[model samples]
Target: MTENRRFLLRRRPDGDPVRDDFELVSAPVPSPPPGGFVMRNHYCSIDPAMRGWMDDEPSYMPPIALDDPVRATTVGVVHASDNDDYAVGQWVMGLNAIEEYSVVTPGHFTAPVDVEAVDSPTRFLTAMGAVSLTAYFGMTDVAKPKAGETLCVTGAAGAVGSVVGQIGKIHGCRVIGIAGGAEKCRRLTEDYSFDVAIDYRGKDIEELRAEIAQAAPDGLDMVFENVGSPIMEAEVFNLATHARIVLCGLISEYNAEERVGLRNLWQLIVHQATIHGFLIADYAPRFPEGGAKIMEWVREGKLRIDEDVQEGIENSYDTFMRLFSGANEGKQILKLP
Candidate 1:
């Protein structure tokens, strides 16, 4: 534990990231500087957004620099502290890196989390974490689901999309989830209570659009989009008048060498719909407000969040690839030994 192991970004990726794109290195355990603290990371969050961050492009956050540990959100405990406000052994979660240890300062992304307030520290990366907050604000504030209206969710089986569909149901909206494979589609209805589940696997854009049209014959009043491009284009073909589209994430294009542009944007103009880009960082100040409400639903058995936990730093690459491969069942996490 004395040596800090880090998964460093060796180079920027061209298409899908390869193992050579990152290098695992061991360095001396770092000590906290003035007004800072050192945290021993227990779990690293594996999200699709990490792929986007690796590319040298404009984004909400800076691209991961070459030779630096890949940026990620981690839940851990204070191993050492130089800050008066943070004490050793306190549980915290923050936008850190894929390393055994992290030097942290109290700021927008680094803060103490109450372990007693939740079931487990890993839950901070799932249910009561940024994933849930993204779903909450996207539905409650942006899309604004209304009773009896149809809500179409792309990537509906994912961490954010699953929560979004459930939130839609809570508001009395009919939920239609579009996911890959039969199992994921089944889970949309049986597990998440989505009214209809459309399997987009092995289907062309028109084929997928036809299914969406059948599932939501009245046209979709709201769309919670996670996977972009073709899936989003398919959703657009079935929009109701004044439909709202929440652009949460575009996992499909994140790893593409060349990003795909939508051909169905004219549907938005025809329907007089609106598409709003959403970033969770913009809602940092209201995290407590959203987290509390999500926790309330979770405690009351109205919400369910799943986690796919893998062990060891060596498995980080494969674990992370699950986000793009559709192999992960829920919120992908890499647990540090």
Candidate 2:
């Protein structure tokens, strides 16, 4: 008998999610109904945002239900289809959960993908994927950084922040990145080619503030925030006059019960700065325009991509923890059988 295995959400996590929080069970492979297609998942995304979806509370999207497959972006090739709009061999990406196969429709989260534009289809989940798209719209639309302006990115070695710093460079800004460790901080300057990098490994707030001030000596014109604890707290103090803080995420507080409070609201008022939180889904209407520009840069060698591809469906839990512990380099993805 053909069987499909899925990771079901067994419990809500405390500080960090463990393999015990989920259960993998076997089920019959689903057949696509009319106007639907079945996808054989190739690579599934392990994003920081997926951590937010497991809680039993309301937010941007509904929480994953108990005993249900966890939510995630799955890229795959369609193997069976009952719909004319989709072909059997077509490649697609969507919120297909952490499963080997998922039923999708045009109105669902699935979208057809073109893998020929970059080095590999995996780029569809990295450079040309939601990661880069989030960076593009966040910078161009929210931050609106200009040439000679200084932009600092937190979690700068991460999937979104890496793209954020690079895109800032492409737009003619002085880019600075803050990563957790020395190696990642080095990769930020050497690999992604950011102008400056600050290592927050064992540093305190004063140390981080001094580093930010030194790298961006003139103060920060924009902040592409990803981490939201001490990293964010220190950066907020260095904001230049009329600075724009695009709060893309708060990974530092995602797993905790009591969120780490930002104690520097006075800085925003003192500098007359603006802080706005944004979601990539909010800019869905402009995806084609955003995706096209990112791909153009990739093909022209103006933008770079780094991905940490881990194999196996059984390793999803450990693979996900890497993101929180700063163990994974670049975008984290898992290949399924």
User: What would the per-residue lDDT of candidate 1 be over residues 167-215, giving only the tens digit for each residue?
Assistant: 9998999999999999999999999999999998889989988998998
What are the runs in model 1 whose C-alpha is more than 4 Å off?
Answer: none
Clashes of each: 0, 0
Clashes counted in candidate 1 amount to 0
Predict model 1's lDDT versus the native: 0.92
Over 1-337, each residue of candidate 2 has an lDDT whose tens digit, in order, gives 2778787899998878888899888899899988899888899889999999998778989999888898888888997899987899999888878988887876646688987655677877886678889999999999998999999999999999988999899989999999887899899999898999898888899999998888877889999999897888899889999999999999989988899768888999999999988888877667779888987887888888789999987888888889989999889999896
TM-scores for the candidates: 0.99, 0.96
RMSD (CA, Å), each prediction: 0.8, 1.4
lDDT value, residue 214 of candidate 1: 92
